[model samples]
Target: MSSTPDDSTAVIRKTALNAVHRKLGAKMVDFNGWDMPVEYPAGLIAEHLAVRSGVGIFDVSHMGDIRVSGRQALPAVQHITMNDASKLQLGQCQYSAMLYPQGTFVDDVIVHRFGENDFFFVINAGTREKDIAWVRENTRSFDCKVEHLSDDFTQIAIQGPRGVDVLQKLTDADLSKVKFYWFTRGTVCGLQDILIARTGYTAEDGFEIYVPTDTATSERVWNEVLAAGKEFGVLPCGLGARNTLRLEGKLALYGHEISDSITVWEAGLDRWLKMDKAEFIGRRSLERQQTDGVTRTLVGLEMIERGIGRDGYKVLDENGKQIGQVTSGSYAPFLKKNIDLAYVPLSHAKVDAVVGVEIRGNAVKAKVVPTPFYKRPKRS
Candidate 1:
């Protein structure tokens, strides 16, 4: 398939489960070439509250799933990603990024080490083809293999306080033993060959279940999960709530936070990079930049006034000098306050510093705040 022009306005295509979403009365919207549900009757705020208070299920099949396996897979993957994939143990997952030759980010992904010399990568849907091409091109000289498995499987994300409780009723797998950022394959809800991972975008406890793309199985499991989650008030959430929930957690979005123009360190995702690892794409540039310090960085901002912050809003100082721009912003339903993520000059990113967000022609007062506006209460 050919890539569509960036400015094309044709109606976005639907994922395989669009029928299920429409049957549930989801409010659909165009999201990066996919006609995805934004919210349901409960609305975005209600869905947000549900995830924070209880649990919610999301249809995340739109995300690309790529498979990499072969004898030389470890070394080939290590060369493309900034993280040290060669050191990953089986059953562990590391959030990492694929970089361009020039050291700019191509996509931020979670690489799951499922076996020796084998891994699975969950990449942003928008960058699916680009990521595949980049990996294939780099690995062509090596003996490893790479395949795009996005269409071969479906992903269901169950997130919130009661997520584990709801999921445990179906799977005999020891849910308690699964640590954060870890996963294991087991039977789930009587379904075989399930890949359950304790990772999610929401600032809550959850799991992303990977199941084969089958009609009867998908339908049965979907119905079973909804029924099992009855006690938790787990709403069928959509992309609207998902984005808000992730932003509140200060999780970086691909186009908004870590784009081709932003380096991992400058995007505040330096922790995911492994600088000490032997040569990888962008390592030298990142290492030099880290030693020299990044000029601009992504930061969290809180509105001190009534107006809600939205993406692309210009940031300014008291004197009306433009400083930065909002990358991700919204009226946080949980806090009932406007919150945003923006990139500002390193000097202006100090915590508690007062800044101005230009909404329209007026400069609204705002202050830099610590990230993850919502943190899930630690479960014992």
Candidate 2:
């Protein structure tokens, strides 16, 4: 249930709540060199349904947190990311990505504008070190300090329709005023300086709380949240459910949907890329890709047959020629259908376009469908 690093061998690192996950009987797996929980005793399907209907808490402490501060912080951030950091007001967050010079993704990130001279970046877990180096390497000419603060913080995401109600019980901050893509700092569960943000990967009304990594504080908050959420039927969810939830929402995974080889245009993330910006890494390449147009584009696919398409699966056209590949796929529990996200040539990316997914060497029928296979109803 628990693993420890040895003096003579390499071992995966564990989060602050690794012991707590084991105590809850979670099925643990090695995820990118981190011991993470894949599912709990309730099983992946049940956990997925719990988050869709009620509330579910996820231990997302594995995510990386980087801080950039100084007078030139904004400029440094603007130079590295594709989004316009200048448009962000204090306490606001924006979904963005950093790109390589070739126009491919370094990683998708969330930029939190904490102050005029300070910014917080939340990046993918697997690319934490690489992202930090990239940020620091690019900030050499600017008067900014890049700090890797991932080890100093523990993060938890409480998601679902009833998430706000459950978290409101423990925090004094006004949950109603926290709009989407915004964050506020306040006391939570008697602890001060907790950053609660109204953002989530599940495409639901939820909050992600960032707290210091003190063992006592982390365990206390985790336990208190679960206890308070009892009335709302909160489940301790795992990565398996998290993946399914995000996939249904059409959220991209690092290696699957977007990668070092996938450009912003091909990934359908052009909205996040600001081409008008005077300068930024990958701007030239992205501009050229935009003007010339990308040969392939990511699209949503719904399987017409019983089989489920998976990553690395080949996508075929009507003439049985391979057109693309499925990047992410799963049997969506909430929708009760098999769906996938794939990259296909421009000719085959149109909605309702017929295609075939090579499943176990057999071409299965599928159709291009609208993305975000599932969307949460807008809260009135």
Candidate 3:
């Protein structure tokens, strides 16, 4: 459970599992007006390492879930997003982004297709309201219904190599048969109406389970998963570990890696943008940028100096001239080194290109390396 206040004076909203988080002695912090746990008693490093070597669970209930349905759902999704939603088969999910008319991101989202006319979108928590409003405003031209389901569901992420082993004990679904990016509706921990998806933010084989917001069901599932995972050295992780895990995998964060000012081309996500498909929002601008070429591109950086590169840190050329800025940075627990993602001029994005990162008012040498500092081995 969570220890945050619930009175009118409180500014943050607590998740249904807030009390359970508090009971587990989690160190809670204000994450964009949500009282979320940053770490547990074992600390961030321990939690992070657990996910890399074994299994760990995360409370990601703050994520937004939006439903788009009706006869024109496919068309509505296709018009607003850059990806081709028509290609998605039932129970399939595609990683896509919504862009503004200026070719910059509105948000990066995961599009999950439930059926021919039903689609579920998982969006960033901080931008939930704005994304919902954007969807509603632009989707009015289509014959679809957009519903915000963020408040009606809770999400838990079970990650790492042993993720399947632990979760298989609780869910009746055939864990081994769920392919990556696919989802199935099944009973979890004897509870009905749960959606289990073979998807995760961490660079590992995992599952993200979505359950109803009913307090009793939420508590039961959370506790039962913990009990089932105890033998696998499963630890309850927090946002801090989640950040490190995702950073090692070079995953994009909303406000940091990709934001309102960052275009999809600059963010190194052009493959997901289907230019051949019918026109969508930002299509013209993105097409122009593609033809002209983007000035700056996102790249991965490895620190050569002792200091750690952090967000907003200036990326400078060899002569100390500002070239770009770091978006996401951290000391990756799995890699055992300081790594970061930054946007630099196209000239400096080559592999092994040396750049300087401003850390604590001093210039620290860093090398532009290949992205996804870490990648999981293929399962045999």
Candidate 4:
């Protein structure tokens, strides 16, 4: 995921594939605090199209992982996350969020159930330290053990239509059997006990593979994946393409769409908020907010005027009054238009409602539209 600057320290972390990305002429930037590739020689638009049309590989090792286990693991996970982890069976993963007591976000996460007492959390890179500390502080009373395994794995994502085909060449394991949101552990590229999850940020078919953090192993698998998908025109994608793909898919980013100040209801993630679940971290606050009702809401906007509405731009009403702010905005490469997600009052959120976004001191014409501006066609 692409990120905004948060830390100003001179020290910057790099993934194991950092050398490889540099060798491939990827333009590296200080993303949050990591020295990460923002775009490759192929550029952002081409890399985005590669994933939508065929396949593209991304070195997403900067993401953090946590292991929760022991007899009380399920209860511990349920206590921290908004989603009900008890519903997850083996090999299943669900999108969830760890929230504050006041019902705001700690970070959005993917919780995977490895066993009855074993679960893993894939957390946002930018909040690694903060999230780890939050989980530890919150779950200290539970009988489960929380292990920080952020440095143990180099996570890679092979996304787009031909992603499965590229991966199938390296392993005999039936990639077809791994349903969406589920995962399987088996040998991949001669390495044992690799975890391949059928999950991706892109609204296209893909898989996220977990391999050792060692540079040699990481690079070998990375090169093999590119070689395997050579016939399909695979591109080594970077964070620039990653951001646009998720935005077009209507996915949320941490500081942008969600934050400690933004409640689940405000972000419109009511389905996963799981208010019915017993006594999670934010349940009480969420219930109270649900009863009182939320004032502002997350809404999608499309520019009817020429300018691209960038992040932090003021959302305005017809009289040029500031009503809300653009959380995330960009030119949708796939959809071929400018779009944004913003927090606006319910009165201004109806479909086709005319609104104005302040772009460069001018009120640019925009309208409320259905989100996920680009959804992949269903496969037969």
Candidates in order have lDDT scores of 0.85, 0.91, 0.91, 0.92
Q: Model 4 over residues 121-189: C-alpha lDDT tens digits?
A: 999888988998999999899999998888888899999999999999987779999998999988899
Off by over 4 Å in 1: 1-11
Q: Comparing 1 and 3 by lDDT, which wins?
A: 3
- What TM-score, computed on C-alpha atoms, does each candidate reach? 0.95, 0.97, 0.97, 0.97
**Tens digit of per-residue lDDT, candidate 2, span 116-207:** 98999999888887898899998899999988888877899999989899999999999889999999988899988789998888877789
The prediction achieving the highest lDDT against the true structure is 4
Clashing pairs in 2: none
* Residue 84, model 2, lDDT: 94
Task: Write down the lDDT that model 4 would get.
Answer: 0.92
lDDT of 1: 0.85
Q: Which ten residues in a row have the lowest lDDT in candidate 2?
A: 1-10
Off by over 4 Å in 3: 1-10
Error of 3 at 123 (Å): 0.5
TM-score of 4: 0.97
